[model samples]
Target: MRQVIVLGAGLAGSFLACRLLRQGCHVTLIDDRAPMSASRVAAGLYNVITGRFGSKTWKAETLLAELDAVLKDPFFQGVSQFIHPIHIYRPFKDVEEYNQWSGWSAEPAYHQLVKFEERPLFPEVIHNPLGGIRILPCGWVNIGGLIDRLQDIFRSNGGVVLQGSIPYDQINMGQKTLTWKGEPLGFDQMICCEGYRIRQNPWFEKLPVQPNKGEILEIESEGLDQLPFVITKKVYMVPGESGRWIVGSTYEHLFDDPGPTEAGRAQIEEQLRLVLKVPYKVVGHRAGIRPTTPNRRPILGSHPQWPFLYTLSGFGTKGMLAAPYCSRLMTAHILEGAEVPEELRITQFKAFRPT
Candidate 1:
């Protein structure tokens, strides 16, 4: 059997392990003592129209269909039919701005998403008086549950998992082997899904990884039960299953610590308080570093120096949306020797040269 060792038990790592297992490859996964990852804290909302600013992403609808297929399998534990279309309310800055956008029907992008007389998803989500626009086909994922389910599926397939970190020096490319806790393990390939930890990876350290520290808050509201959709402004309040929701995120460029900051907590709270007419209680707060590239695209490919080594990350805040399709493409490229989509190719970024 062709063996593969995967580093990092994150969303990308776990998912890749499952896919490799499905392809009948021997797989082993390693991560730190803490199993809780960034994918854990994320509210995992996927949207089509990126609202007033950004352009519509490529193949969003097709990717959504593919996601539904993979995530719907019985092996997925946290899988729920809770994937519902959300109406995003864009709080107008003023009447003048609202009128300007309303007149943008001539633009192809503006004509694609909105419709007339749409009531806001949640009544109490207060915004500017000029009302808002409705974005179609946006929804949230049970991110934590999905990660756990993937891990379970991976283990069930005879995939070995270690609780401690793997040392880079222990990896021997010439021998195609790894020494984990002083024990030798042979593998045909190794893929790193280490997220922010990729910055410390000696093999691919040269790849520009701009890790950003972000924080989020989980909250509950009695008045928010009627909210079946997501609300976004400076921050986002993504509705979760049951009566729960997540408010986030405060972006900090300098911090590496994943512990929730008082400033980040306060920023989200203040933003939430502005739109929320009803009372809500803060239940949880978490912080994690997001692995992003300068060009705002994922880094995926074999290392220039090591053909057997691969990377699969840099999905940033859109991991829930981007990973599904991107993982499939990467898996096909790795296993079937197929070509990767140009947009997602790691070579797209000039700075991603391997050592």
Candidate 2:
């Protein structure tokens, strides 16, 4: 029997397969492989300090460092070239805000990530009069490209990758067999890493998974590619290849279709124009639903009733960093009988038995 079977071959699923393979477990991945999934539509941003108040995110520093460590592993040496540790410049709204943030930036606790600056970046093309501070230990990942490359590597070693959905009704958990389109396959264990689509999986629908829809745009503009890093306010602009710049991300919790909309495009364009002074044309637009939780932490553990059945989801928008580290934790918990961190434990959800 195959040692493991993973559902939804996105970032979390891909990382889990890599981890299990490293531990000598025979593994297979399953997914429908949608091109415009969350992992593909995401800007892959890794910001430390976010939100309206500009405060640091939960354990941002530690997670950033852990991401660096994961990327340095032998398997990711030359292949994972998409992880870019670029600088993020947040322009101050006014002199008062600049003075206020500059004081906080001077504190020792903010040393690694906060850096105060006087001059602006690309003054000729940006409206950065109040100056800005650079957010260090931040960057982005080309998640779509990374996933594709990892899939190729995974398949090269006789790793099985089923390109269609599994039939839940035909799954015989008692016999440790899965029915993929009427074909039965045996596996010792199975894990579900389905992101926002987890609601479709009856076993995990009650776990408080919140779907957050996000939209981003790709614009083509000249003379701005040399800006060197990402810039932010309500929206952020990041450097892209070949004179293309990526501006993003508006979050909506009340949308119907998980597709691009005129309102979303307008919102991004209006905000992007305020901070940017350059001429540009909209080249691309995309939208995806993120799988988030109220607690803002990843949830990973086995089913209370069935030990062989497991789940791994709720990395939210920060999956780029969260998935790799949490996958390691999950691997250790599974292969070595180690305890999972309290925050990430699935038992935290009320009465997790199958319905």
Could you tell me every candidate's TM-score relative to the true structure? Answer: 0.89, 0.95
Top lDDT: which candidate number? 2
lDDT tens string, model 1, 1-355? 9899988877788778888888888999998835335676677878765644635666777777877877577655455543455766555555665566666534776576654323343454565456555566667777777777777777876888888877889989889889988899999999988887787888877777777778888898788777555777677788776667888887676875668878889888888877788888999888877777776677788887678889998877678777777777778888988887777677765655555
CA lDDT scores, all candidates in order: 0.74, 0.83
Provide the lowest-lDDT 10-residue window in model 2: 71-80
Clash count, one per candidate: 0, 0
Off by over 4 Å in 2: 353-355
